[model samples]
Target: MKTARAMRGAAARRSGRRGEVLAALWLMAKGYRILGFRLRTPQAEIDLLAIRGRTLAVVEVKRRTDLLTALETVSLDQRERLRRAAAAVAAQRPALAGASVRLDLMALAPGRLPMHIPDAWKGA
Candidate 1:
């Protein structure tokens, strides 16, 4: 039973990753240049890093049964972590450092179209 549950969880994570990739591609179509996926720093992991003109976007992707749950997944601590990660990424890429940074959330729930919340949170 434990093995079955683990497998299910892994499958769900993979599915969510796929959904995020699709969403990233959709953003690309809208002129967002994808910088990285699953970028990990000492502080945190950002699901997607994208750029549009002079704006740098750090995206968090959540797959849940409902939008509220997905939105809730990104807690205050997680937001701070993402902020640190974005800063680290910017430090590594000087061009991006001068760009305005924003946090974004992409939620994908079954039977519903994906929802993107730009500037989802401002780190305190």
Candidate 2:
């Protein structure tokens, strides 16, 4: 039998994946093309990568009881990590080199539409 902690971890992973899917769909509806999903880089794993016009969006999907809580969950360190991951990915993809990277957050809550916050953090 799985331990309680293990079960909780599994459930959290499932919820995170579900949030990512919802975020991706929401972005698509808003005219963004998703370039990567659950993209793993040396620094961190980016939940989603999207591009529209001259901007490349690095998105972090967060699910919580409310939008405020979800928004508060991302730490400064996590933001730095996301930036690093974006940089690493950009370095490897020539097509993305010239695109301006924008860090975004997709906040999901129960019984509400996903909230997409563009330029969620200023790039370092």
Best by lDDT: 2
Candidate 1, pairs of clashing residues:
none
TM-score of 1: 0.90
Model 2 TM-score is: 0.93
Summarize candidate 1's per-residue lDDT along 28-101 as a digit string, tens digits.
88799999999989999889999999989999998888877877888998888898889889989978868888
Candidate 1 accuracy as lDDT: 0.87
Q: What TM-score does each of the candidates earn?
A: 0.90, 0.93
Candidate 1: count the clashes.
Answer: 0
Task: Please provide the root mean square deviation of candidate 1 (C-alpha atoms, Å).
Answer: 1.9
Error of 1 at 90 (Å): 0.5
Q: In angstroms, give how far residue 110 of model 2 lies from its true place.
A: 0.4
